[model samples]
Target: MKNKKEMAKEIIALVGGESNIDSLIHCATRLRFTLKDQSVAQKSELGKLPGVLTVVETAGQFQVVVGNTVGEIYKEIMEQTSLGEGESSDKGSRRSKGSFLEKAIDVVSSIFSPIIGVLAGAGIIKGILLILTQLELLQKTTGTYQILNAASDSVFYFLPVVLAITAAKKFGANQMVSVIVGLSLLYPGLVTFMASGEPITFLSIPVLSGTYASTVIPSILAVWVLSHLERLLTRIIPDVLKLLLVPAISLSVIVPLTLLIFGPFGIYVGNGVSSLYNSMYELSPLIAGLFVGGGWTILVMFGLHKVLVPIGLNDIATLGSTTIFAFAAPANLAQSGAALAVAVKLKNKEMKSVATTASLAASLGITEPAIYGFNLKYKLPMIVAVISA
Candidate 1:
């Protein structure tokens, strides 16, 4: 019955208060804790907290599983403990004392954690469409297929909006400013420049050019920079004019700066990654596919897949399309096959239930549960699939 905030306070108290903690981090479902003393930390006590699902002491860290809302719980804990007190007066100061990695991870987690459900749900729906289309049952030209594709693809097509909101939250900038920056990418002039194919000139500045649809690095980086600039603008300006003038000042500064710096920088980074991927492809398509598809699965299992998702998106945007999608497709298929294999082979009720769920999740292109839950538990088969693929 207790709220996440209430439970966060209790966990902070149990972990010898906020001061005893050297650092804290979190994954999709767990609060990874590094404390001054593992013995005094009392993982058992923290595990008993209402919101906590489980406790994992692994690799010299005490991980408290808070399910999907770990970020919200973390925010409450930080607020109650004044964890970011020294970093920023309003918020984000709690782990100001924590290491750079802690802060970076926290920022990343905060941005993606809230939107993960939507991402997974959309991805699942898209996966179903892919399966249906590939099976020759649902023609892409059909009205039903078109409508379903549109419904599923909306998140990806307008991904900048989602990133804008989350990035604003993470950067402590005004949501509207972040949104404005995202909008700039879709501006008429920008599109006109792309249409003309005559070298993008940002205010006649000859800006670097690349499509931004489904882009990750550019928008995220732009928003991050804008968030900081917005903070500075918000810090200044008269109190009487804070509301209206702040946004105006931020957009004036950020939009121009975004075109000049972040936009080009993102384009370059995205292009660089794409080039690197292609250079490897020149070595061998089979190698590239294996690396992308099979290697990617391994990375996703450990939550390292996010690093590549941006790169893959960047490739698709800068270049026309990608084989990375092909790579990703196989991992899903392999997980699905492995899960189905388990469902057929296993008779235990609990095991059957787990396998059934895993099979469905994997079939829908969500292999993490299979990778981390069932596949990783039964190590040999996971190894075999990854190797054969």
Candidate 2:
């Protein structure tokens, strides 16, 4: 068997080497690459590589599916390439290749991927707390419960700050500045003022006060603008003065812009999406459930499921619960069930072992291993799983 390092090197080479790669980011189970030239990539060769489950080309990304070890493989690739240190490198050619929708998906996925694991952990803690409280095992009033609840909710509460850092990385802006912008939005004084229903203004411009914490679009838009503004400043500002001026200017401009424009716009967008989804669910929950349940895995296959993650998160933030996960859980479990059946029925020993492991992983709510590794490999199982979901 090839070691992870060897596999990583081979995977990078097959995907047209470091120079061909414009950027690389990994999700839970795949190393997603934006290549300068996709045609040069040896996709078939990559799928045949040891430890590689499959190759999925979608949303302008060349995704190498390596199942659970994707993180290790991604680390190896980064260590072997310049990508980690080349965040500011020009990617115009790469950017120009994808359609607007593809670019949007790629950008959103990259921005959100780094934090998904932590989000899942926090969510699990919340879920466990809920279960404990419902069973009367833990009182909400207890210190233990309060501490655990804070631990779980902290990520969501400070989500804008967290997202600002990630979005800054995605947009190639100064991370600290982006974080400051996010922090400004959620600053205790500002939040308190907004809650108090007091009028505020920035330089005579009336700021539209709204909740920024736990929201998605505002921080992203702010960081995106910051990226462009930073570039312009770099070009115009004297090199010696830039050290002092760039960040100072960016903060002054972006903070107010975010407060006055981006923050409220994002709030509206988030609210609109949540409202639309809820309205759809209310109109015909059966159809909504059926569509989300049956097609969730399909969306995952194309890396489009991420588009719904924020909506689900927004639903939780605004409505205290979400239908997205409610429908998705059964879909995930159905994949596990289908994989379990595959494990039992497969005659080949190696195949059975793979199916068994995939089954276990899918059961734990990480379904990529099962979907790409076993279920999708067999059409009937995937079809049955979809229908079952």
Off by over 4 Å in 2: 88-96
Q: Could you give candidate 2's per-residue lDDT for residues 34-67 as a string of tens digits?
A: 8889999999998888788888999988988888
The regions of model 1 sitting more than 4 angstroms off are 1-149, 197-210, 345-347
Where does the lowest 10-residue lDDT sum fall in candidate 1?
87-96
- The per-candidate count of clashes, in order, stands at 4, 0
Model 1: per-residue Cα lDDT over 64-117, one tens digit each: 766546778877777786555442223322233256654554455545645656
lDDT of 2 at 189: 85
Best by lDDT: 2
TM-score: model 2 vs. ground truth: 0.96
Sequence-dependent TM-score of model 1: 0.72
